[model samples]
Target chain A: MELVVSQLLTGLSIASILMLVALGLAVIYGVTGVINLAHGEFVMLGAYCAWFLQTEFGLGLIASLVPIFIVLALFGWIIEALVIRHLYNRPLDTILATWGIGVMAQQAVRLMAGGELRYVEMPAALSSSVNIFGATESAYRLFILGLALSLFALTWYIYRHTAFGLKLRAITQNRDIASSFGINSGRVYRATFAYGAGIAGLAGALVSPLKSVSPEMGTTYVVDAFMVVVLGGTQSLFGTVASSGILGELSGFLAFHSNDTIAKALVLLAIVILIRFRPQGLFAARVRT
Target chain B: MNLTGKSAQQTLLYGAFCVAILLVPLFLDDAFLLNKYSRYLVFAMLAVALSLSWGYAGILNLGQATTFGLGSYCMAMALKLGTVPVHTGSDGLPDFMVWNNVTELPWFWAPFHSMAFALMAGILVPAAFAALLGWFMFRGRITGVYAAIITLAAMVVVNLVIIDQQRFTGGFNGITDLAQFEVAGLAFDAYSSSTYYLVAFCLSAVLLLSLAITRSKTGMILQAIRDQEDRVRFFGYDVALYKIFVFAVSAGIAGLAGMLYTIVMEFASPTFLGVPLSLSVVIWVAVGGRQSLLGAAIGALIVTGVQGALSESETFLESWMLIMGGLFVLVVLFLPKGIAGAFEMLAALFLRRSAAKVPSVSQPAGEAITHGEGAS
Candidate 1:
């Protein structure tokens, strides 16, 4: 029972990270109609930025989050303006374009950081662990889980209640109709893209301390995020959270008993089988055309 | 008559190109360059397969490396098993397997001892796997990004499997220090410069076969599917069959490449089956020009060559992926057609300018000058 509880906590922490990564991917795909292959690279960039700041200037991990998010948000805007704008309405081209961007970003990181996996020192408070249900756990893991869920709730609230969220949704669902409804679709696109990148940045900053901060670290998570998005229904945020939680927990439990590689292969095979049956992902969005 | 005129020119150009490729070893004395070119040539076969599926049949199989690695592993197993009599270590069973605690060969692994069976298995296993995958995917019309995603997943899964199966697949260390062949009384030492020549000869032969297939009517049908699947279906073509056929053919070529790769490198690792390797293959195709068979081969050569060179350099070497990534972006965004396409376009421009200098009387009826442009 204690083992299960610890597994659940681990699952929740991973799911939180996945949620942040998939949130950006889902939003970009929803609003812009582009499967940005470079989304993972953006997350990597954000993590690297925080790592850089932590190492060079010795900034507080929480304080570094602001700069990471802002810088990535601006980068996202520039990507949208420069390359992604032209790739709109062409899904295949977007895949290719973003793939190019991903490649460039990965190489750039390697070049900048000199190919070594650097360690990020988490703040002492964040590093502390607390006992939960007779199982000792890292407080950092719980904090991340809380932060991610709250962020999702915040995003959901904004999506339902706020003016910007509505506009973003409007633009995504039906661009022509949204334009006709007097919403500036362009501004909504830029904002959503930036917002998505910022969320990914936040996740990266959270997870930087846990994992080895390397140029290629993001690719591994991106694959899992892709599986989550595909399984969860690409456009639905709640579905992403649910799928990530389930998949993460299942894989974590499997890895505990079996080899890590076999566990991953099994999860991938399971996802593929699921996709074969349900071509439209689990919890298909009603608004999806 | 129109077909006859174009095909004749194509035959002549291809024939000349083949001769030139065969003669390349005469000018280049470096065994390393020859070995490198041979490796590239093997990849060229793989690229031809990719073009068959991606360029013609519109199947974006991002897991071709899985098949390539399968073939390499098959060859490595054969070589490993062959060395049992010669290098009989304490407790036998090749050095790596002994270390991993396998006293005897696995029951399924016994057949690879024979060269004939091993070679056949290398090609056929990948073909069988691709056939099964293509059967489901093509039957369901899983094209576009979904197909790409599925194949990408397959790549990750295959690499994971290979990495996990430490005893059979050699884990992350992979299979190395295997003996060369004595097939049909020919003593083939992979380490020698002569072996590189043999590899080069085989590469040219494969290139010829690939070219013939690309120019065939079947190839035209495959390209038509790439352009419009619905239209071909309307015309009563077996769309699924064609997709499977192209995919299987591509897998076979990648298998052949892997076989040659094992012979050249004498090492087959899980890295051969990784997502990065598959993605790099796609990059080669995109950079070379998707439809052109020759272009695909050249693209693999150029990209691999550049990577090899850059990776060797001290200062800029560590950051080589950045350079490659920038190149990928520039090529895709600006050079939509690819390096081969750009070069072809330039050649056409020069030819047009040269033809302009000729008098009006020399120009043929219905304009032969415009034919190359439209066909390309």
Candidate 2:
């Protein structure tokens, strides 16, 4: 019972991180219809952003979140306007182009930061382990779990109620009609791209404490996040939520019996097989063409 | 059929290129340089294989190296089995198996002992996997972005398996210290200049095979399918079979390159099957001009040669990747058709200036259209 409980907690904590990463991915892919191969790099940049702020300015991790979002969103806006905007109508070039951008970003980071792994010291308040129901776990893990759920709730509310959300959805539903209805798709796209990037940045900020910060760190997470988003269905938020949780839990449980690398490989294989059966993913019906 | 004026020009250019390749060893007397050039040829084969699928068939397969790596390891294993130690108690037990404390030879390692089987398996393994994969992806109507993602995921899975099974697969160090590549009582020594001929001869053969395929009626139909699949289906063609065929054949070609790579590089490692190599091969194709097989091969040779030169020199080694990344971006954005495309444009312009009323690019009506690829 203790082992199961501990594993479940581990699963939930991992799921929370996957959720944050996939949330940004799902939104970007949904609105822009881009796989955004560089989305992972955005997360990597976010982690570096947090490390930079904490070291340069002595700001706490919590204090850096807002600034990280703003900076990352601004950075995203520049990239979209300059590069992504030109390639929006040309989908295949976007993949090739974004992959180039991803490589450049990774190399740029490597140049700036060097290749060694860096650690972000966990805050003292959240450093201890907490016992619950005879199972002991890190306080930070629990904090992340709560933080992730709250963020999801906030995102859901904004997505459902905000004017920006409506505008974005309108464009996604029918780009031409929405433009006819006086929606500035260009503005929505820029804003949507910014928002998605901002979310990825924040996820990176939160993730920095848990994993070692490196240029290539985003590669695995991004791939995993893509699996979550792809397995969840391309355009469904609920699907992202459901699939992230299921995959995270399944991977966490499998890791308990086997090793982490094998567990990861198995989970990825399962997702590939699952994709074979339900290419629409876990939630949505086939996209009516 | 008799060749048209444009085709005659293309043939002339191709002959000149092959002659140039044949004469490379004479200009460069250094055995090391000859070996280096041969490795480039192997990579050129990889690039040409990618051009067939991505350029003509419009598959954009992101895992070409997976097939390449599999073939390399297949050849490596067979060669290693031949060098089994006398005191290992069992015949044909690879050194790694002894080091890992395995008492018996694995069943799969058995057939590799026979030279014919190993040579056949080296080509067949990757092709068969691709055929199976292509069937699943194409017949199920899972294509475009999904196909790309699925193939990449499968590659990751296979890579992990190779890494995890350290005892059998040599972990990350990979199968090294491979024996000399021998064929019918003849040895292709790594240090010998003749080894360069072995690779160059095979490369031209593969290149010729690809050119023949692209010119054939089946090649025309494949291009048509790439342009408009639904229309082709309406014309009573089996679309999936053609896709599977091209994909499998492309894999087979990559496998052949992988075998050559094993000989040139003298070892097989996990990096050959990894994402970085796979992506680099795709970029080589993109930079070469995917629409032209010969151009793609040249692209690989040029880009890899430049990369090699830059990476080897101490001043630029650290910054080479960054520059390459920048070049990659510039190519994808501005030079989508690549160096070959630029040359063709220049040639057409010169022709136009010389002959006032001549038509440019006299591709047949049936062979003209090719759609820019995308799922969205």
Q: Find the candidate with the highest TM-score and give its number.
A: 2
What lDDT does candidate 1 reach at residue A67?
A: 90
Model 2 TM-score is: 0.94
Cα RMSD (angstroms) for every candidate in the order listed: 4.3, 2.7
Model 1 stretches astray by more than 4 angstroms? A176-184, B1-3, B84-91, B191-194, B211-218, B234-238, B308-312, B347-376
What C-alpha lDDT values do all the predictions have? 0.77, 0.83
CA displacement after TM-score superposition, residue B154 of candidate 1 (Å): 2.2
How does the DockQ of candidate 1 come out?
0.41
lDDT of 2 by residue, B1-376 (tens): 2368777777777777787888888888888888889999899999999999888887888789989999998888877776746557656577777789987888898887887888898899999989988877787666666677667766766787898888889989898878888889998887667888887887788888888898888898898787777888899999889999999999999998998888888889998988778878878988999889899999999999998988888857777767777787788777878888888778767877797666645534413442333323
List TM-scores for all candidates, in order: 0.90, 0.94
Over A40-143, each residue of candidate 2 has an lDDT whose tens digit, in order, gives 88999999999989888998888899999999899889888878887776666677777777778888898888888877767779989999778999998888
Clashing residue pairs in candidate 2 are none
Candidate 1, residues B183-274, lDDT tens digits: the string is 88877666556666666666666667766776788877887777677888899999878888888988887887888888888788999988
